[model samples]
Target: MTSPVAGAVAAPASRRPAVALLGAYAVSLVGSRLSMVALPLFVLLTTGSATRTGLVAMAETAPYALSTALAGPVTDRVGTRRVSIASDVASALVVGAIPLLHATGHLTFTALLVLCALAGTCRGPGDGAKYVMIPTVARAAGMPVERGIAFADGTSRAASVLGPLGAAALVGLVGAAGALTADAASFLVAAVVVAVGVPAAVAAIGPAELDADDPDAAGSYRARLASGARFVRRDGLLRSIVGMVSVTNLLDAAYGGVLLAVWATRQGGGAPLVGVVAATMSAGAVIGALTAAAVGHRLPRRATFGWGFFLVGAPRFVVLALDVPLPVVLVVLFVGGLGAGTLNPILGAVEVERIPEHLRARVLSLMGSLAFALIPFGGLVGGLLSDHLGVRTALLVCGAVYLVATTLPALRPEWRELDAGRRRAAEVPAPGSAPAPAGAR
Candidate 1:
């Protein structure tokens, strides 16, 4: 079925909203990636403590996870457009304040943590709001949800590549504070792009308005949240996805937030190497995502997911732990990125199909929350491991854990559901159309 918001706009079949949404997402994500590199370096350089670096990461993500979980119901009630714009504006202000405070000699660790938390809080809903709009935009563009999400993933991967390179340049030329200033500017631009580019009517229709006849549409906040939670708890595949992703995310956080930073510092390549490392991986991911956009729907979901996870996990960690040559490290990470790139399209399409249209925002948010639940502690765990066990050992341990968490779940029968939705969709005849011949895709 078409999304509730897809037909809200009566304009001719156009891809304008979809393009705009993707553009805004890409711009904002570029800014976020810049900060992702700069912020860790900033903390590591200033405090000279891996533990405190982890602490700062925790402070930011803790609020992010909480806000993401809580924002689902609010996003369902408030228009996605409004929340997205407001969140971007707020993020710009909070992120901009960090550099300003530092320039004024007033920035402290506590203040930095507080600002990061505020930025994270603003970011959570903004990200979720944008995610909720994807299916609507896809339908509007006359595209399959998987293809659209693959494009979205491609943009994100592109941003990941550019953001790091930019971060390295900005940090080298103007310091972390300056890179942060650029990040703030990107948010403002993203906010403005959404405000002008996407049709207000299309994005402004919330679930409550669209699902007016349903009693749950008018329910209170707690009731709405409970309903979303109940839906996730009962879905076997989703539950498995949530559990597996939670572990991987936590390990990823530790790797990104602490271990990677420490490694860069030790190598004396500093921010530039970090950027190179990140950019290469993202570059590979960009290619992978483009490939997925082209042919993902034709592939078997179960095998794609299983192999993708296998490729994306463990290798980079092992390479780094082995202290391989720079070229060798880059090659491994690039291959991993290829695997990572195929993932979101499959996951996004499945989740969008499974959740009822009316419950999209709430359900997606809960899933995101659960998936990211342990991420806050990832940095701390990484830091502790690095400090006590040494960086090499920590990397090896994390790689092993990642290998297990992502691979073992594929053995479960529920994971076979990954391809079922696609099969069902293929079998259903469109309105006014004859059924396909037997064995037709």
Candidate 2:
């Protein structure tokens, strides 16, 4: 299972320093994922209101947009390892507060939202650090940049793919608060792991030419912001990638936003079946993630992304349209999940390799934010379409939109260069880079 991903290629298994740092990063990501699963489940059980569920989801999401937007620059200014550790420690405190508040019997829903929002703020920086740190670790380990990215992506998939069910099991055994306690514990573990492990890989001196400490590094905060803007704007490869992925995000959000409820209702399966659907999707994605790791680094990143999107996108329509039993649905969903699983890690590796270390966090955050920016819109659209347009019709519309979005980048000549990113060094920066600094580019 030793795939050729662009990561710590220093010594196969002999690179102890690199391995330690990567291990710490992986642990931190997994710990964060575990908390992500526990938080929502805890909320649902305490108050079985879908409205509240949606609201909580929104609270978490709003902060993600805001935090994700800024995390990149902050990560660039401070060391990613330090930020990762600090955020995890902060996250631990926030998640731990939930149980503490509940224990003291003052855990109002509004208070819960505020706490979740605070924790939500940490997610962006923490996420940005991982992206920013990967290449540094890969370079330290002498691993291929692609392999480094693949390893990171693979670990994230493995950690997150299993988080929710584990949360549910904990809830069943010790109640939601207990699950929250464990979530808090995971954060602490992650913080400790990063502190002890990641420094070796990340402690290297970065290029001062890109240093935020240089008052002349850029200009105003707005100018610094624009640097990333211009990079993304002018980079044909980045533009194509972001456009296609953004579309996929929108369509997936549409279906995911409403699929469980709609499918259960259509299939005459109850609310519990929603859990079954989610589990099936997760299982499928886990399988896909593993498969992607097997083939991702060996193949061209662009090809992997395109084929994977095809796999992830095409079957979704056919599967959702079926009236088969839950078992059958699960099987097809797993197959579909395989494609879905391939997306994040492969592209994540590509972006890391293409961008500079100092700008790594900002570029990754901007790209992720754009790709996922439409989730809320998709969710709302799905809900509305299902209510007024029928589930099957909604599914059809989503599928069409997905296809259109994923393929849109292929239409332009400059974007065609994206397929050649592995061979091409040139990029057209995003207009947003102008906000970073006047002379940034």
Candidate 3:
């Protein structure tokens, strides 16, 4: 649905792209975290094996990878708004199917896996669109992409905090399948936000020669794909940044999945412990979002991004695995979230800034695929490690790995390039967009 574009939307753009980007994403996460909580609970309640929950996780991740890989050109060709609206609805329908099937006694592992795959598929394309939208809006509004994306990432973290907590409550009250229905409802809500809340502002069409750098013009989709892949391979900063983020993501997924719950179980906190831990991290993440909103622009994004990995990664094990009290763990997570707040949007800005529009989706997808590819393995390995070495030991081991993965990238000269590529002096306003002078921040 197209609407008349409005004046720089800080005051009028429904959700304010920079902030709306974050808020809308936050709302989406509400659905995701709720599902994350509900799916496992449903499987556990129905089948009595915690391991069964991994199937749902697998389903979601598989499609996430596939869609991410394929969706980039779609983001560039069709524009982010259309892709976002369509994907959100598709995701809503898939999530809705879960509760529908449960009601009819048709819910089965096979069914759940299929649905999760569908959602993942939608999410990949949707995420690509969302990333494209962020820069487009920020450039239009004369705001830096970093602030907007950071705000968006932090908002996402806030939802991460709330969604699981809501899921836990809903699951406790209405049972897990019922929570799935609510999760489905959130996607519809997300669709509404993307379709209506976001301003339909397209990236400016420069002259044909100006558009010569278009990555998709390789004559065929497969060739375009190769072009994008080749571009990334040739870029030192982009490649290294992707590697660092990917490793960071892998470790985070491995350790952070049911992290607090595992620890709580060890310490004799039963079924409810998992929700509490998730909530703690969520709360930390929300606080982190606010912090990002407050300071994202002023800080050096490359450094901020690295520190974010350090904060959330290194401390996860240290704070949770220790023999400290539960309240103490909550505080640590809250502080850790502050770091989480800055990591995503900064990197998002970095990724978008360095790449041409044509390669955006492919690079983003490849990065996501590489980074998250091993999460399942991380889970499998983590689960086994937790079983034998104690959850605390597993967490500590993850923390040590986090240090190694995150540090290599942080120390690289390429990080300096990201800073140099988009300085205030050299900032290239998206073609046709008017931006404020160097003093805006």
Candidate 4:
């Protein structure tokens, strides 16, 4: 008999749901990138304080990390579809309120921070919910897992390129506050697209482990949360990835949130330069993602993961520290972006293949939370480093650290497992078929 997992994977393929999911992902990601540029510029322009800029960034990301860590069980229990929709709606309201309050001359820094926190809290689970839907939708579309994730990552990278450019243009044309209004509108559009276009079943797959009718199977929320954590703890490769990624994420957040902004401010390039630099890197990433989408499955995972990080990690930081001309920096970042592009598809494929379907949301959320746990402090650290050590020194220091964190782990035995998923896939018998005889090969 076909296993339920196999049966589900065998469901008649259609491209519609996949397209819808990617569409929603693209829209919301672009909005996020816009805010990423607009919000920092808004604070810097108004307050003229790097420390405060970091604080505001923290206000959003701290709650985001905490909420994402805790949201997995809730997402699994409430259903990914419902949680995703609700989160987007709440985020729109909270983000929209920022400009509205500012326009009314009633916006306090405290209020802005609070609004950012609310938006982050609302966004956390929604991101996890969407991530959980990827495998199902990929299978439904008959796309290979790695290819599907590559397409998704490519969509996101494309949005990154567009969003920064759009933010720069919007900020120039209408100021940061007006740009924020557009961000709010994008969230609403994403929610509508997901609701109308994605099939209901896409987000509702897997055994109903949390069903109320099966009280014994449906454990307490704490137990559910603990279960996911325990699995991650036991899995050596997952543990390694999470640990390495956490440090890298912290450094990346610092680069994006503080270092780049400060550089732009000091250089008198302001928001436009920041957008150009970011877009250049993202444009390169877009090309890299497309390349991965085409032949990633044929590549060696361990080497790709290692080299991709090596290329993406240290070069940008080194270039920025060098204070090279704009053209040189863009070229380095574009190359780095290419390396960065290949990473997620490999990581996503490994993660999906290794994780049990029933625990998808919780496990993925826990992993994401761990990876992002240090991000809240990233801005603050960047600010302090730039203030005390100078931007060039800080950039150099961060680059060295990133190099060590991302590359050293590849030497570990556990990293060999990065390629294990492909081997496993090759060995598995088709649904309803007997395994090949041991000597047949």
Rank ordering of all candidates by lDDT, starting from the highest: 1, 4, 3, 2
Q: For each candidate, what TM-score against the reference?
A: 0.85, 0.84, 0.85, 0.85
- How do the residues 73-139 of candidate 2 rate in per-residue lDDT, one tens digit apiece? 6766666777888887888898789999999999999999998888888776776676666666665
Whole-model Cα lDDT per candidate? Answer: 0.86, 0.70, 0.72, 0.86
lDDT of 3 by residue, 65-155 (tens): 8788777665655666777878878988998898788888998878887888889999888876776677666665556677677666766
Measured on C-alpha atoms, candidate 3 has an lDDT of 0.72
Instruction: Identify the runs in model 3 with alpha carbons over 4 angstroms from their true place.
Output: 1-23, 45-52, 106-109, 172-174, 203-212, 270-277, 319-330, 387-393, 424-426, 430-441
Model 1 segments more than 4 A misplaced? 1-13, 37-57, 99-113, 171-178, 204-209, 212-214, 258-275, 320-326, 386-393, 427-441
Structure candidate 1, residue pairs in collision: none
Task: Give lDDT tens digits, candidate 1, residues 284-327.
Answer: 89988989989998899899988888887899899999998999
- Against the true structure, candidate 4 reaches a TM-score of 0.85
**lDDT tens string, model 4, 1-441?**
345453344545467778888898998999998998899999898889998887898788888888998998888777787788888888899999999998999999999899999989998998888878887777667677788899889998898778878998999999999999999998899899889878777655644534543332458989888888988999988899999999999999899989999888877999889978988888889999999989988999999988899988989899988878999999999999999999999999989888876677889999999998888778888999999999999998999999999988878998998888779976866443456778775
Stretches off by above 4 angstroms in model 2 are 1-14, 17-33, 44-50, 200-209, 212-218, 271-273, 324-331, 424-441
- Total backbone collisions for each predicted model: 0, 43, 4, 0
For candidate 2, which ten residues in a row score worst on lDDT?
A: 426-435
